[model samples]
Target: MSNLHARDYQPDRQGTLDGIRVLDLSRLFAGNVLTQLLGDFGAEVIKIEPPEGDTLRGWKTEGIETHWKIYARNKKSLCLSLRDPRAIEIIRKLVPSAQILVESFRPGVLEKMGLSPDALLALNPSLVVVRISGWGQDGPYAQRPGFGTVIEGVSGFAAINGFADREPVLPPMYLADGVAGLYGASAAMIALREAEMKGRGQVIDLSLLDPLFAILGPQAANYRLTGKVKPRTGSRSTNSAPRNVYRCSDGHYVSLSGSIQKMTERLFRAIGRAELIDDPRFRTNSDRLRHAEELDAIIGAFIGERTQQENVAFFEEAEVTIGPIYDTPQIMADPHVIAREVIADYPDPEMGHIPMHHVVPRFAQTPGSIRTPAPALGQHNRELLAEIGISPAAYDELKLAGVICGG
Candidate 1:
């Protein structure tokens, strides 16, 4: 349904970051997600990996072939072993031409590689350096290795995310890392915009913990102001009763929320329980909340007899707040999501037409694109080296010396 032609979809031409070049030296979820965000907005992102490649190359549960094919999309890849002098020399040659450098190693890894922010800035003072880390570049745990799961646990997000009666559990995905990457990318953009105005670049030290800690939001505020640590209350509205998921006939689930008296009455009327509106315990929201357990029993008894479609139709016609508990398959099959074009088909040389989620905050003019497939290890090593004016003989020599690899 998109009217734009592939030829006319010049990525950089649309986004404000039209001519920005990013040297991405990060890997795994956090760093990769950030680079993907920038790439989506028209920046030219060159992802650098070690010869063995990013560890995420094996992320897919199915197999390496599938994992590597999809995770590295929309960018060029260059595999270089930074420990080698030739590799360092090659990176140095790249610095002068780059507008930004995004790296996600432990605190001192870049300095050890002789490509610290200070050194890179010395070569190109206009370069913005974004360093992503679990604990940031300094502090007691700065050098410690961590992943999304660790941050989730430490940040107390896992503590308030499960059923009240059950032990706390981590969310089943890498939400912490993914969100951190998004925030990091946002910070990078702001810094870049400021640099363009001042004609001077700045460094962004983005800590995964910062975003993780900030996610607590109101809950943190509650604890700070009231000394109360919020506990998990699955599907239950904090302020009202009868605002939770309920089972319907045909083994389907439906969510209901009627916090206001009018909405509650509408819900009751929809279920043919208008008489309950006058009942003493159900007269007010406070009264209903006080006897929530009894109210849930009554609501459940009425809802359990109806099929999912029947309940959904009744609620829709009445305009009461209710919705289906959609699983992934259900979401994919939904006509609304389909009409919105919320999914993208990413093509790869190894795997044809891989489906991926669409980027959010769509641009009106220079919309970002997944134009190219994921790189295969060092697929762009020669091209990149050529851009840096490295002769073909030198490229071959570096490859032969194990400083770089060619896919």
Candidate 2:
């Protein structure tokens, strides 16, 4: 029923990361995101899930595992009851053939399971182990559970978010997890490259707190310089002026940024208030920042007289930077989004076609492709075990002993 572009799975398509093998032992969002990135680029991502499956599989929409379906695409699932020593041995056996290993367990959990970074390195000397936690492995908070929500609150992202008078607003989505996952992917590739070239492996201590805090962009330096914490000013930049979301006549909102001098002047002219360009309160960037409230009132009044589309068109014609604040439906319906196939309907067994984002950072020569849909629990257990020379009898014995499960 949707008008979004449709795409088919290219299972045979090769990607830039072809031949790389990843053992994903992470449970939820952050690990899934990291492995998904590698999987998208044609890495053999073996999701080593517990018998209960990855926590993401339980995140359902209308009883459909939509989150898993999206993030777990191009990945193979192997279910095992990690409580058993045989299961740990199976993991150890698989490590020699795996280039990378990702785990999101709390600090010391892997070591408790007798699969410490040292032990893993002993088994596979060139294996790049990515240890993801809420905090660093040896930190004071390492023993505490490292959920993304807790990390987001601790990372100072919530502090500078939302309105000044209101309480700090934690991001509704998985901000800490998402940022950590992106960082982990890059770090994994770097470690993998080093292992390949130098024939040595290392452990990456990737914490949700570190990556999220690193992206706050010199907040510490700014605080030290000003002797103050930046107050939350919703939608308004602390550094730039004439930058805020204004409501249009039709009740739709549009974000306009006149951060630069020329753009502000052009915006004033487009609003038929060219004289305000030289107004003492609105002349320079600092002056405009000081009087942002009054400037916003003037701009808001002009914008409120027009619909979102009208304001966008007028500002575009005037060569000022402005765009509509789109909701999901609006984004899906936008001409440019459709043209670019930003969201495409891919074949889904239950939904017939489910819309998800395209592979990001597109390449010209060796572009990534969605090779397959999310696999069922333990779907690749037989095939994957075979790769490590586990025969059918041994696999059946392990399954009987409850070491392997699902599929």
Candidate 3:
């Protein structure tokens, strides 16, 4: 495999979001994703975990906290048992200095814990409070446990995801949580900008359900017009024909798309089947969609005769759009991925080196940097407490009383 781009932590590098502070009291994927984005852009993110740790820490591969390491980089951890009143007080003290606060608690849990948006906003009028849940804060299902899996099933994504003959399929990855995280990041930035301009804080009611549903793209309107539900067509496009993955002779796969008329003709010519372009069953996009099975059979046969690389080269030479379906190993070895440094290796104490994605949405002048590894649980307890005027004696007492733990 080609060497991955190697990078070292640059703790002093500044980003556009420098001086902004985020207090993250969220667990699992969505919250981490939001804070990670903020942290990458130079916000000082203080992850307030429970004594045990954020739930992401428990998601280990071969007993390594891979998920936590990736998501929690550029963050500081302050582990506290929030059930204890003292820990709650610590959060209240930190609120005055923090510009943003994020939590993924069920709708009323933060209110019950005495850290409601109103309370936090009162502490710092410019504080932006982001509440993430499975559903909206005041809906009928607001109190439901909002795991991403449940939201994925209900968001109508699974309904049209796989082959119609098989049962609906949930995504293999955290699709709901990932989408919500990206939405939350943008929403938080919007809210923060408003707060900065107006000196008034507000609460963001972010739900996994809403963001996931929004991205499904006019499903309700389509159903209204067609009076029919979309069927699960596996990799095939419902509106476009000749858009599917084809197997190669070498057991690899390549995805090909001929979504437009010119592209369909080009593809037909490339595959030495130019006559199919005018054939009654495959003349237009509508005709091809109606006979996609037969069309796929014809295209698949041509692709199946060649190896994946050969097919890719041949199609590119013929000016037809095509690409090999890449697994992780293939992705890591690709020269384009290497030169672009899409993934790079970073020094890690435990694993010696860990591969991580480069900072995203690169800016020309103020690019972000990874300044630190994921913190050991509670690694910043003393440092954070000291910032809030907690002396050594008080810090020791909090530890002794089990109000603080994990470092």
Candidate 4:
């Protein structure tokens, strides 16, 4: 049976976030990723797109690479041309009924559109507004046009991610955008909850820089306490020894971490070289780190006898921390991934059972759900307008004026 039909994998009839309504005014990856996440958690997200539609609509493959199809799952699209006063009026009407609003335009763009947080809050005192941007809304670079790669470079992540001998490598994925979206979503959720508690609303100014800054891990701490800045060390960490990726007999790679003494000793024992535990050159983490090349060579020689899978199982059995550097197919085929239902088969309106990477942070009673597929442009325009108290005559007038479009 398909995993979607597995008895235990059923979605909540009453999803934890079932009653919340989110108005998504964001575009591109960062904002869309956030709204998609909220929708997966059962928020009724109404995506308000401009008449030109999301630019990502053109982000396609000749065959089936629909970036919009995946990233925009579980939201209804409502098209409005904000240049028309009617379109602005319609969004103003919708704001009172929405619990949250998310936008990712440059600073001042939404205000120019007449959908500013202060304006919306006047209409709905409890509305949680989340504004996402590459830089913050108030920073010196607030007006600058930026994207994932640019911000990743500016945030110092790209600088410290590549091999020491080569130019700094850009991350394979849109790490900045995606992580910023997560931070925005989390901030929106918290702000919404706080607003509900206080009976007042606030705007969440979530910058892409926040996640880049937060994701620095130890780099920020090291920089804060000392005068030194971090450089690219490839797979090695700043705080530990024997914590780099290694090659196995099958020409596959794996990572092993052993910063603590007991774990390092265990790793030595697992390789049948317990004498290394007492060796002066590798007794402490500091010593092992100083002689990392020698220690890594010794470990690599032992790993040369085993396939990645064999090594993974052997180290796991021996209570050593290790992971096979899995490819996408390998990850999809992993037993633990299957057991966790990390991949979901969502029924798309345009296509059959489209697969999606499932939601995270599971709940026993009211977990998130993938309720609906992404809509075609302006798919829910009329319906959303009707829900927001627009009369048929007014809707027709707006459509005639090129202010509202969907039909």
Candidate 5:
């Protein structure tokens, strides 16, 4: 059992990003996820929001916007008006010490606010700036408003994700934004290192339109070479056979992927169909794909005759690849998730005893932790301003002037 003390961890272990600082001027999932990645690895992130607050603050379920809480953890929230000159001056003051600055304003929004990359980099020569956008910082479509759903459709992602006959489905989650955030986090670190080596700052122009399209793996190459678009084969792998979800006797779904020859042979033998292995129509992968529907029907019949647990037992004993489809409840109750501590207790003052997935890509020597809960709006404003030499009297005056607002 892990305890909440430094002594509990190995003596040599330390947070890898302990000394780095980030100023987040971004909104929504893409920018939030990117900064959260850095925060999870021990960067001190100060999230600067407008006086009104982030738009996601109102995205609620039963009157709670858990999205804000989940993505804003391990960071400080500072509320200030960008339109105010005093607030702009305060941001300028904070820039010199920040190692990273991330923003997701549209192409020209930052420039209009007088906080462009060129100006920010000039203020702190060693800083790394990550500018997240929809179509990107420049290009014909740069200024067009784009959401994750819209981008998924426009990026050629949603078009090929469903059954060929069905209306295409957007991903269940914010897939494009999340993928872009992951890429942005990776790019930020790389740019930071490059800046250190070159003794200057660098700007990362990240677009949500790019990463998801880049990760559609091999489809682009296949199309370029063959001039053929891949048809959607619902719940089946386009490149392999016997890789689809099957309904068991109890009505629970079990997905199987007996794609490789070894697993295919094992599956056939386990199902008492050893004779079919030598049959010309089912002898090779290419041949099986040619008759995938027929093969899938046979496998489905076998699976349908057995309960999910029984099928699981048989697949485990036979070394055939399979897994029961799980909803959120099963995932929370799963043995493996518990054993690995994948979900951790995220203690919050307002929303107590919340469960959140813990930090990932854990390191042996420098693993990170969720040191703080998500901050209340402008929770760190007083402390942050005080650190920058603002006296209490001056702070109260600024708050009264509508230049800064924080509780």
Candidate 6:
């Protein structure tokens, strides 16, 4: 690798996770995202992978696995075969120094490898073991392998998404997995806090299905009250009026959200229809709901008359909530995106500029930064092994015997 990729950003400012160490025994998307979240905040994350590297590293964009480049930033890599006992021994040695361990293997894999929660805690009494699985660690569906798409379908996300006319949509994104990773990261923090206070650590049994379901925002409550599954309404929200995507004159689309009375008034005023605010059919939220289609048509027509940029400017001036349905390039070029510093580019010789999203939820005092680039397989083998007290000779022996993948 080049010097720029090898170099990591060391912020002069303090970070919230500066003293933390994490052992990431996960691959693909969800678990990897979780560790990256921690690492973004200055956690020393060591990713343990099998010899061949993470399965998702093969996934490509423009002939590059861009996902790995962004999500695995600020973390080190250690390639080791979990099938080997010495690998487990190496992990046990790491456990004592690590504050958190994240894993996404199927329910019984850890137990099979003799690295169950009990065994891990025995090695490090205060370790926060975060376990994320498809249906959780103990349920009937726990043993079966599943990914974000499968979980979305089973967890009712797909059921509530997309148009009623078409087959339920599996989101283009990894919806469930991303939600699960956030939930898992938050759970790990809570567990770490409690462990520090109580002088003991515990296992976090987080399910891929549950977190996505939990974030449905009153969908379950609505179901319980009505005893009916909410019908899908495409891009429109079932709970609100005049909430949908509308095409502009320029053939671009923009999303509008005039859900509340205040926002609806602003929208109406901007569209030169202030008189509609006092009309009986659009006075209140309930009244507007009854005439949602009519209101949507009015708004959509107004939007259709204008170019996307014109509508964007009008919404900005009117202070109504609106946004362009931007593609990747559009978003990257957006003014607000640039102003917020949403994307940061790093030095990459081949790619020229490696653009990735910056760390989120800005902190006034302890903000996170994009420090390191993604690691090559086993890039941190020697340095990480040294921290765990493995000698140079032992490392050579392990590599020679195929006990470790990278040394």
Q: Estimate the TM-score of every prediction.
A: 0.90, 0.99, 0.98, 0.93, 0.95, 0.94
lDDT of 5 by residue, 1-407 (tens): 12211211122323788779999999888999999889888888999998878776777777776888778877899999899988999999999989999999888988988888889989999899999998899899999986788899988888888898899889999999999999999999998998789968888889999998999888778999999988888898777887999999998989999789988989999999998798787898888888888999999999999998899888998899999898877777777887787776655555555677778778888788777777788999999999889999999999999877766
Please write out the lDDT profile of model 2 over residues 52-147, one tens digit for every residue.
999999999999999999999999999999999999998999999899999999888999999999999999999999999998898688889889
What ranges in model 4 sit over 4 Å off?
Answer: 1-12, 63-65, 218-221, 349-351
The most accurate candidate by lDDT is 2
Among all windows of 10 consecutive residues in model 5, the one with the lowest summed lDDT is 1-10
Query: Which portions of model 2 miss their true places by more than 4 Å?
Result: none
Candidate 6 lDDT over residue span 1-407, tens digit each: 22212223564534688889999998788898889899889898899989988876788888887888888888889999888898999998899998999988988899999999999999988999999888899867878887888999988888888888988989998888899889888999999998889869999998889999898878878879999998888888777777899999999999999878799898888889999999999998888878877888899988999999999889989899998899988877777787777876676655766777778879887788777788888999999899878899998989998878854
Tens digits of lDDT, candidate 1, 205-267: 887888988977687677799897886877776678779888998899999989888999998
lDDT score at residue 118, model 4, on the 0-100 scale: 87
lDDT of 3 by residue, 64-95 (tens): 99999999999999999999999999999999
Q: Write one digit per residue (lDDT tens) for candidate 4, span 215-301.
A: 788776788999788778789876788888999999999999997889999999988899988899999988887888798899888
lDDT of 4 at 104: 88
RMSD per candidate (Å) reads 3.2, 0.9, 1.0, 2.4, 3.0, 2.9
| Reference-based TM-score, model 4 | 0.93
Q: After superposition, how far is residue 182 of candidate 6 from its true place, in Å?
A: 0.7
CA lDDT of every candidate: 0.79, 0.94, 0.93, 0.84, 0.86, 0.86
Give, for candidate 3, the lowest lDDT window spanning 10 residues.
1-10
Task: Please give the range of 10 consecutive residues that has the lowest summed lDDT in model 1.
Answer: 1-10
Model 5 spans > 4 angstroms off: 1-14
Judge candidate 5 against the unseen true structure and give its global Cα lDDT, from 0 to 1: 0.86
